[model samples]
Target: MNKQLSWLRLAATLVTGALAATGALAEDGPQAEAGSAPPEASAASAARHCVAELAPVNAGARTSAIKQGGCYSSFAAAMAAATDNTVALASESSPESVGESDLAAAATRVIGIDYDGRFYSGSSFIWYARNNFGCFGGRSYTANMPGSFNNRLTSTRGFNGCTRNTSYSGFFQTGFWVRCFPNCLYIGDFMNNQTSSKRWAR
Candidate 1:
């Protein structure tokens, strides 16, 4: 019985050592797969608000960009769907037609969009003004980058009346300000990957 007990202890020790080694290897392994967002970015993307796509010619025709039965858990995945036109509206709402005036009005609500890659090639974040009221009449839009997105902006586009963008190197619109009027296909070296907060105005 003593010999059997010793054998059992040896087996348990071996198993524990193997598990520890495996865990160490996993910790030292590659953090993420190629072309995949980091775990923190994926989590941030899932936590953000869902995005909707508007028709290029007629913005009033909106479609949900989120997948059916599940939210987009990765910004890259969401951008892929947006680029490939694979997104569909929720089941409760079908596509609808709108008047020309409505389309024109709808087009002016989009304020800005930030991208993680140059020329808008990666994960994207968009901003919209409430009730189509853009940054005008002393109204402005501002926000600090989320934890995962901080220092991640590489490009940006501004539309409607919020064509003036001011990027800051610190949160709360502090630090050196880099101004990009209208749009920036690539935020220059001074501001690229250094933007922690931003503001948009007419």
Candidate 2:
């Protein structure tokens, strides 16, 4: 009877060990499978950012215009997508006509362009505004950088009515502030890659 009892104990020990091994393998299997996916997913998500165009709805209305365009992979692509192709051609026979057309074009133009590298290299974000009324006669506009673009700007330029750029180190215009008059060929060390928000104005 003692020998039989001893044999039963040995059998139970082996069975318990086998079950524990199985449990460990089960836990490790899913973890191993899932580990490789997040990095790739994170990279793809990071690469996706957006570009936007803004405009007032109507003349003297202060808020009524058709805004269009969407996200793109590069600054050049975004610029192409946002540009107005239906611009009226100025009559070259009259210098006054060309001057008027140039003024009109400048009045409704890109508000700001931010670059990820100094000297305007690397990825870029273009903010185009229509009906801005030139640099001297437009309302101020402020915007927060997108999640992927926050703290990524290294250079910037403002145009049309938005000729002044103020970069903030925190979202919603908090933390440190740096002013870029008309443009910054390279954001200084303090603000380089540290901009999270921006304000544009005449």
Candidate 3:
């Protein structure tokens, strides 16, 4: 009888261990698949790195943009200084190679302007996202900033002016501006910022 009891205990221990192992494997499956990032992430990483590299290319221009007021901060000036500045975009602003998002519900501390929108760091934001397998196609955020951002304005750009049209995918119920000029798209700053950000992201 004692021998029979010992054999039964051994059998139970083996069964318990097997069940635990199976459970662990099941949980790990989806997470492992999700871990398989898309190739875009690699590209985004490279882009961010390049942005950082370009900052030191010219020193005099940097000083000029700075010694004068921050009003005319060039692309380099914006990148070099970490201080928050209010930027204004022209009529009908649509960001490049990005998707539109609405975050008008979030509470934001006033960086400078009471422009009521939460903008993202457009270029770096999208580049990093695409490289990570998340993309919104050849569309920029389509929102309306009727002089104030009531939603997330991609938060990177202080403010840019854009007309909300469905064609550009700007058909949004809420109207808020995304800061493009001095914030994100300073005439091809996308590549530079993306390149530099690559190092930061990784």
Model 3, stretches more than 4 Å misplaced?
31-63, 67-94, 97-202
* Top model number, lDDT: 2
Model 2 clash count equals 5
TM-score per prediction, in order, is 0.51, 0.57, 0.24
Candidate 1 vs candidate 2: the lDDT winner is 2
Report the C-alpha lDDT of model 2 over 104-138, residue by residue, as the tens digit.
Answer: 54434666778786776556676666654534566
lDDT of 1 by residue, 102-194 (tens): 223353355566767787545556554434555655556666666657898888776666668778899868898787886787899888899
Off by over 4 Å in 1: 1-108
Best by TM-score: 2
Per-residue CA lDDT of candidate 3, range 1-202, in tens?
A: 9999999999999999999999899888876677766777654333220011111112223110111112121222222221222222332232331222221111211111111112332222211111111111221222122211222222243211211111111323222222333343221322222111111100
Question: In model 2, where do residues sit more than 4 Å from their true spots?
Answer: 1-50, 55-69, 86-108, 132-135
